[model samples]
Target: MSDMSEAPKLDDALGSLPGSRNFRLLADIPVRMSVEVGSTSLKLAEVMDLAEGSIVELDRQSDELLDIMVNGTLIAKGEVVTVNNRYGIRIVEVATAEARMAGVERRG
Candidate 1:
């Protein structure tokens, strides 16, 4: 078996692995996390006609869970929640490791 303790250094803005495969090596490093409510694509003319009170329709239904993304990758699905007036997410489902890797591979 290959010793991950001497794992090759992966260079990127995300941070280096310090020649080890220990998961804790990355536990403290922060990442950009975001919740995607929905998405829509509009033509240039439609976008130019925006007003003060414009309503843009999205592709997902209201009842559907929102996508939870980290570093531009979809990692989970969750619903909205509120705690002490602050909005948060109630995670409903998490993507399998293979699926998450697939997303990362596609972007890479």
Candidate 2:
């Protein structure tokens, strides 16, 4: 096997770039962004039993941070906020570039 330790880091690869033009080129590209409040899994029987007024419990606590995703990959965590009766997210933490890349790789 090759020495994996010899592989260049993600930061190193990015830092080696000569200019920001390559990065700027992608600035106009659009990506899907979403926020996940929580999730729960149910058996087929339970799923079928869901009704209009049914309440399903999620794994995450109400006070917990929500997952912020881009193109289905988690890139940050945030909390819900309300402004003028409109709902929004208040970003509390962001994942490192390496973490974001790792998420993309996992999904790929």
Candidate 3:
């Protein structure tokens, strides 16, 4: 790891580069991700009553889209789907840049 003082500053690194305004550099930027959606709770009785094939219902409705998150930020909304017998989520709508950036800044 390098100390902040020893590392190139953001302005020095990007400002001095050629084609700095191109967005290609950011196309594949990697980031940590996490997600959260509506939740529900079960009592001790319910917990104990659960069986091997039991299903606990979530707070969200079947038609509702789940939130897709990146680095704990809401980036998009997606509906659950099935592809090749595997479960997946298809993004239905994307959050705005301002919203995503606000979330990232808030966490930082």
Candidate 4:
């Protein structure tokens, strides 16, 4: 008969694993999220002449999807929607898992 007592035992407790516990800790951490509709550059004089009703065109078209940023990194694209008279974004596309992990690595 072969002796198998020398091998290490695998841990079954979730909290005993450093990676699992660390991720659980990070799950509670808050991150800032923002939605970008569009942006435009205007001269100082042009910006100063703006009035309440003045309209300034943006770089993106009105029908274009908005960008969803997490801690300043683009993670998804969405569109604006109204819910109960409040403005919100409906996510249309999300970044791949690899891309999202890369973004987190870059931020860290």
Candidate 5:
């Protein structure tokens, strides 16, 4: 870790950790983040037959934690919550860095 006593370099002062300079370069880049409740594959005909009020059963149980993904990689798991009348997620578990990297590799 970089010594906290020393002043940070002006060009990369935004990063507070060691190697943060490299991370700073990518800070402005945008990646899609999403929350997944559950997923299930259906036949083409079944999908086509869906109409208003149709119900689709997902693979996950109602009480199961949801997946929080960043750039298609699983980063955490959370449960849904209502915040000020809006939907939100309360993070329950965070994925290890190695696990996140493995997810990226699997996607790649």
Candidate 6:
């Protein structure tokens, strides 16, 4: 019979695993998420001329829900809202599990 007592223990091998448990969570982790809304070539002068209640049309149509994203990845879509004097967005739709996984795979 052969002796197999020299192998390393499983817990010892995995004791140094990396994790995010101690990470600080931020609400807007992806600050550039809304950058890909698709409107291009609008000059700063033109942008500055815009005023409150002036509707600056976006690339998305009225029927299309705006893509809410994080770290440049689409996570959800929703309509804009104002609650308690604070701007908020209501999530009308969320990306599917498979779709989210695919994005992760692409990034990796």
- Winner by TM-score: 5
Q: Measured by TM-score, how close is model 5 to the native structure?
A: 0.82
Give the Cα error of residue 41 in candidate 6, in Å: 5.0
lDDT of 3 by residue, 1-108 (tens): 233488776656776678866644774688875445577898999999999999888898877778889878999998776877997767789999999999889998
Off-target runs (Cα >4 Å) in candidate 1 are 1-21
Cα lDDT tens digits for candidate 2, 1-108: 144599886556656687756765675789999999889889999999999999999999888899999999889999988877999878799989999999989987
The order by descending lDDT is: 5, 2, 1, 4, 3, 6
User: Per-model C-alpha lDDT, please?
Assistant: 0.84, 0.86, 0.79, 0.82, 0.89, 0.65
Q: Give the TM-scores of the predictions, in the order they appear.
A: 0.77, 0.77, 0.56, 0.69, 0.82, 0.48
| Clash counts for the predictions, in order | 0, 0, 1, 0, 0, 0
Off by over 4 Å in 2: 1-18
Would you give me the overall lDDT of model 3? 0.79
lDDT of 1 by residue, 8-69 (tens): 54544235545445655765789999999999999999999999999999999999999999
lDDT of 4 by residue, 16-93 (tens): 677976667676679999998889999999999999999988899888899998998889999987877999888899
| Residue pairs of candidate 3 with colliding backbone atoms | 33-71
The candidate that wins on lDDT is 5
Is candidate 1 or 4 superior in TM-score? 1
Per TM-score, what order, best first?
5, 2, 1, 4, 3, 6
Q: For residue 11, what is the lDDT in candidate 3?
A: 58
Better of 2 and 5 by TM-score: 5
lDDT of 3 at 28: 62
Question: Per-residue CA lDDT of candidate 5, range 8-99, in tens?
Answer: 66555665678877878887889998999999999999999999999999999998999999998999999998877999888899999999
